[model samples]
Target: MKLNAKGALLHRQLYVLLKEQIVTGRYRAGDLLPTQEALCQQFSISRITVRRALADLGEDSFIQNRQGVGAFVTANIGKTKHGPDFSFIGEMRRALKETTMQLLLLETQRCPAAIAAALGLADHEQALHVVRTRSQADEPVALLDGWIPCRFAKAVTAEALKTKSLHELIAGSFEQLGRVAQEVNAALADPIVAQALNIEINSATLKIDRLVHNREGAPVHYVTVLTAPMRTRLVMEVAADDIDGYNVGRLLHDVQQPKAPRRRQP
Candidate 1:
């Protein structure tokens, strides 16, 4: 494996990559990692850099390093399980059938500071923003605020949103919709969100942020989804090898009070 010159982040990047390998069973539990010299030469990095990366892996409960025997994946690194393909698109299609959608707002305008940054738009650049609510059995369950780059705005319309997901419409212009970086946490419903979701102001809610990239890894769409805490639940079928899912499951934190959901540029 080769690593690019990322300066200070190079070590941290290496740490994360190695951690992923272990978590995915590429380097299964009890498997010995390459020696420092071997890793240095393989990655074309310095010996010190390799040492730091390995040290971090050991500290993270992913591996154990012997004095001179090199590093080995921890015996209890993670629990592995088998499962079927739970394609996200398929899940969305199921939701489309189960839940009804109402498009509340759809317009192309100058992007907000946070929205522009998340969608990789320049200063004052325009984007299509959509606000919609999802309901099941006549009960509002989710309020979604989404922003898309102007280039993809053509494929998105008020009517299209009621039928197709944002990702589906946007992918028409690209080879494929690639990876999505998502985060979920506790948040409080704000005035606008509370009213849209038919919940009381300051009510607890679950906030989800998803940044989707094109096949080339350029941001295309960013969305924030808020669900009434009492009416909705986030569920994931996770195994040790599902690194991203496992991490998401472990990171849910309890909050002391309701707070407005914060937007972040990934």
Candidate 2:
């Protein structure tokens, strides 16, 4: 409600606002959009502006308008979240187990300097750069941008990724992955990520920096995961008796599981 239409044209502003709502599941498939009169009141715009916005939505395959009746979200709204040509998502739903993955890019390229260093690659070493989006029930939750040294990239084919998580693939291809150094940080979604996750540009995101090493302690896989902050929560559990490594994490959820109550201090 009350979308600021001063910067851009009012109609275009409404179009983007409504589109974002649809993508975020506010107005789902088969849902009836408000009438022109209602939209006019909500955004303080004229009925003509509302019509223009709705017309643009129609042109973008987001809605089907009728002469007397109002517009309705099309049944194919799932594809509309990204665009019309996203029909391949349906195949991904069936091919992947537990969660669906849309492999956007999979190619071998020379690693970037920072990433190459993380993967322990010398200068000019090529690595497999893989980009994918993970979705649950057709809603994208995370984007995985990863790099793998060419030595182990042979098993990371497009077909192979559809069936396994990147970690699983790394474990299968390479023997005895020794340890993983991972840290979580906060970031903002850029244009590329905003488009991929159907979120607003500069939206808050949870970023994960991950480095995997083999038993010999050579870095093998390097990846960064960007997840929608509102869509996910990270839970880490450590047994009461096993308080070994790092302790920087604060208490989020406290679960008490003990044999009996401890004696009260005098």
Candidate 3:
């Protein structure tokens, strides 16, 4: 690819060139782009220039950077279909009877800085924290952490969380819980997540962040769910109709009867 680096617009030119390759199907979906060093050599640009271009592409959702791995074209590129979003609890049950939850940690405490910001908690506000390991057929799949405002803390308990979907629980107690806004990204597996999910450090983890809202357009809860890329698939169809409104988290799988949670590994 020939890149223009005249004056002070080299990075912008590189960004456009890479984006063109992606849009024109030259790179295609999920194709890893050349490494920064390779790009630097090919385009005769500095590392900073290549980094800037890649950052812009990633932020635009044209590419995803896998930690310890090179950047890749987004899998969603050029697709014309989107999936209907549904509650994970319901979807998990419908997809596999073998799916179960192992409660890791559930507590009520003051929101941490990051959690507070995501959930829009006030200063000194309390939030309910629920951590669980989700699995199917005794095989671990995901690590989930949900934070809800303290205003609703009294309504949720460890026992109450044991059997039903969190969506159903919130809808029953609250008046107008509605759609959720979510973003998915790739991240390195941290020590806690790696240990709980039985994966290695720097392993590929699909990080999903969600902001649940009530019907009044008010944000009610914020959740972060991390899963192994190998164990889970993220599929969404793209279309003009999708732009109007579409569910983004529906899992495409077989429905079956619910089963029991498995014992922990010794």
Candidate 4:
């Protein structure tokens, strides 16, 4: 109802209001929300203002807009978790049992400049970049892009790649996967990913940037995992020691990947 600095109506604020209600369970999932016209008239604002507020809600997966129908509350709003790795691959499977994975393209190539930085490598250093599409049931869910330093790449075969655990492959090759650092945030799916996932160009997804280390505490791998939002949720649990040790520095709040058998959707 209030106008923000841009002299535009404060849709983000209004979005928060509606979102809070849903999160608190006041407005149950599948409950129909006020129509654009009704909201505009109620707030004494223009339809554009109402639309903006609704769009903000839609963007965050707080609600769904049905064409020619009405906007309905979504069941997947606050259920998403932003936390530590705590086993990301397993968390994803628990969130969506219908998950499946297929190697879109896998080959050995010199790591690109961008990829090198991602993997913490020197220029001209060789690494293997494996690209694959992960789906939930039949729908594409995420694009798993992994960069493995060549030293460890030899351990990962095409057959091995088809399995569920890249972490296992790395751990098997080396002695252990001592530590891992990851960053998770919201991002728009790029064109290639959008097309492959059958989502919009700017569709929101969960992006996980990760780096793995060996027991000697040497950085061994870097990866970026992008996943679909609607059908997937992320979960993380923190231990008390992690808090006392100030381990929460680079381990800031939040939560990727595909491996394992394909399960039929229930």
Give all TM-scores, in the order shown: 0.57, 0.55, 0.55, 0.64
Please tell me which model should have the higher lDDT, number 2 or number 4.
Answer: 2
Q: Please report the candidate that would top lDDT against the real structure.
A: 1
lDDT digits (tens) for residues 157-246 of candidate 3: 768777765655665533456666787888999999999788877776999888888776666778888998756766555455555444
Clashes per model (N, Cα, C within 3 A): 0, 0, 5, 6
Q: lDDT tens digits, residues 230-256, model 1? A: 456566655567667444456555678
**lDDT of the structure predicted as candidate 2:** 0.78
Off by over 4 Å in 1: 1-86, 173-175, 237-266
| Model 2 segments more than 4 A misplaced | 1-97, 173-175, 239-266
* Residue range 43-114, candidate 2, lDDT tens digits: 899999999999999998888998898899877774432222222223323335546789999989998899
Q: Sort by lDDT, best first.
A: 1, 2, 3, 4
The candidate 1 region of ten consecutive residues with least summed lDDT is 78-87
C-alpha local distance difference test of each model: 0.80, 0.78, 0.76, 0.72
Clashing pairs in 2: none
Give me the displacement of residue 126 in model 4, in angstroms.
1.4
lDDT accuracy of residue 20 in candidate 1: 71
lDDT of 3: 0.76
Candidate scoring better on TM-score of 1 and 3: 1
TM-score of predicted structure 3 = 0.55
